[model samples]
Target: MSIPSLLSRRAALLAGAFAVAGLSRPGLALGAARANPVPLPSADQIRQDYQQMVDFGPRLPGNANHVKFVDWMKREFVAAGLRLGPCESYAYRRWEPKRWSLDIIDGDQRHAVPTVAYFVRSQPTGPQGVTGPLVYAGRLNPDGPASLPDFPKGSILLFDAELPKMHLRQIVHPHFIHVRGETDADVLDSLYHRLWTMPSFQMDDLAARGVAGVAIIINASSAMIAGNFSPHASPYKPKVPALFIGQDAGDTLRAAAKAGRAAHLTLDAQWVEGDVPQLTAVLPGESEEVMIVDTHTDGQNFIEENGCIALLQLARHFASLPAGQRLRRSIVFAGWPGHMSGDMPEAPGWALAHPDLMKRAAAAFTIEHLGASEWADVPGKGYAATGHNEYMNWPATAGPLNDFVIDGIKRHDLLRHAVEQGPGYTTGRVFHNSGIPHVACIAGPNYLLGIVPNGHMDKLDADLASRQTAMIAEIIKQADRTPMADLKGSDSSLGADPIAGTDSSKRTQCQAS
Candidate 1:
């Protein structure tokens, strides 16, 4: 069957599912008479959209799955009655690993060590691989001296790095309001923020030291380690092959290194140069100014890049409205790629590329990592849910944008959420930095960067996601009615920094690290 036909069948199935779930109520259709306010997409519809994106698998930039998802996103936008805008394309280097393995050779005995994942953008070894004497480097201290012990040339270095123990309370900004379920005891023990920090810096140092390969002993469970593409920033691409060895195998690997054994490391990968596409579609309103609704298309799992689905749902809601009820400002739905790979341009670059759109933009809204349930690795048990939604952050520019986000949270009963200052870690930070008023909702779940089993479909809360998306929809409506001068308040009137207690700048590095 053709793609459109298949999509039609899927839509029918979804509609049937919604009816069975009692969500296909009256006044939801585009032309239906309304007793209530404009209806947002049902939780079931959001889940179906999210599931379709997850089904596309890991959407690393320039990869086949990423391209397929971008195509689907464009088709969905068109189906929602939005007209397509010119898509911006840029060149980027794509990496794909074929096969990789590590073996410790001690005298006559050779022991294989299980690897969780390869460091993305790490150098690849040939078919013969690289065999060299193992060198054991101690645990890395981020604040410690920036020096390493000398090792023989072409040696495979083994090092340990502890994933920082974090709690939801510790990371919440000072301006957080209506905080819920976050206590000092709530441990966020997964590698959520560690994906880009010390690992990449360590890799860069090792590569500079002429190491043939590196084995990193990540102090986390095998499940957490699995599919973790560390050192994911654009900079700090390691020239030496590297692999993540889980803590379970750390003892054996450490022993081998101590015994002065030889280790063989192989990371067979290929690099392809391709074009990364950033898509934009517009829903015309009564006015020329546009509210840029944005989200990245590239990510590892369901929660990581599911914002595009939410964006789509928002588009559907606004587009379904009657011509008489349209907002004052147009809606520009933007889908960005390369959030995961970092090889392609991000929001800042996109803004520079689309000067005309940026010139007309009145405000911006971004949504990502929606409806994530809190999960952590228990000492005795494995990774499991904590019976609470992941703590979410709404960082909006100080003004009507900030007010709208807080008001929406209260009105929607969006539990376990905090509202902070503008330009937090959301992909839409570029707008806030560019003086375009913005508000964004994002959660830093442990599995957001992990692929496959790590960021599985079960981690999402469809109801919560729908509610969050609904709140965003309302915020957009409120922004539409507010005047541009009121939305963009002066810096002097913008009160104390909402991120006063926290290092908002460091948070950006946490994403780019």
Candidate 2:
């Protein structure tokens, strides 16, 4: 059945709730009323689009599924009567992991322990694998390898690094500073200030020392592994294999190392030059100033697919409007595939290829996971990814743009929830660094970004998605109405500092290490 038909049936079933929420009454969603010229999207439409993306399975690079989804998107855009730009095409080197397993060979028995995740672009440990004594590298030098003591050259070095505790703290204590009337940027800044103080591991040190491999332990209770989205494009090159292991596994490895035990590491992953489509659909307006609405088209599942659907919804909405009724500023809808590959210039993605457009953009509205389940920690149960009343993280560029989003959230009566972020990379940083106003509203417990495995929208909150999409549409409308100078802000030093306490100046855009 057609999506509109399905949505019409739902609108009838939930007419009362829509009325109470001040949403258009019944048939108004189907056949537009005389009140509003452009009908706001119904919850049913958002849910349907999200499900369609999920049905396509994962859209990660180096897979046939990625190509399939990209083709599907192009067809959808053309159907919406949008124009694809020549700069949409992008290619990059992608890694394909055939067999990735690590086991501790003790005496005659092997214990299979969980690891955070495999490092991106890490060299494989050959079919035979490398077995060596485990060595504790202690805290990584704040300066670098030059400040560290020497360890065995061929040992598997293990060390500890701080995980993003701000989000976790919000989940545990929501009443702390996550109250209403506060911008997400303010809340994030409060939490992320300590992040800059933490020591960062020098991966180059491992390669320089000729260590077989290295493992990092993030100080988190959950066993989720987090790492750079595009490790291969990182400025620092590592000649050895590396992975992030949870605290429990790290403790075990440290104990084993203290007891003079050995570890066998293996990473059967390969990296080669590959190409994936990067797309952009332009809806021209009367003015030259352009507003960008984008999201990554590739991820494990709903974590990013929901964002893509939002982009599609925006495309459909703008395309439906008559050219004369279109807004003043042009709108560019971007669907980037290599966003998972670190979104670097060298990585063959949108940001690297479109510097002129990036610089000229007045404001950007980036959509990631819209309606995601929130995760919580259970004392004896470990981490549990549950709850429908979860909050989203909206990281906006500091200054007037952030002020505008905060005011809009209240004006639109969006649900008051903490804006906690997860451990994943995004395209927001790139735009922010270039002094472009950017806003991102993403849901919590994103499993694709490695919050934890098994976080899905079981009882999908269609209302939340609708409200979020409406807010984004509102932001775009306001951007179009407001002058470019006002939306872009006057402060040149705003995005010069790295986003959320990470030194992104060194690494290419789109890193969450």
Q: Judged by lDDT, which candidate is best?
A: 1
Runs with alpha carbons beyond 4 Å of true place in candidate 1? 1-39, 106-110, 141-151, 164-178, 181-199, 203-210, 453-455, 491-513
Report lDDT (Cα) of residue 384, candidate 2. 63
The segments of candidate 2 whose C-alpha lies over 4 angstroms from its true place after superposition are: 1-44, 61-63, 141-153, 164-200, 221-223, 226-235, 286-289, 322-328, 346-362, 385-404, 415-448, 451-462, 483-513
- Distance from true position, residue 313, model 2, in Å? 0.9
- Return the clash pairs for model 2, or none: 116-225
**Compared with the true structure, what per-residue lDDT tens digits does model 1 show for residues 124-240?**
997778999998887654442255677899999887877665544455455445433344234233323322223453456666668899887877766766776665655556778
Spell out the clash pairs found in candidate 1: 196-513
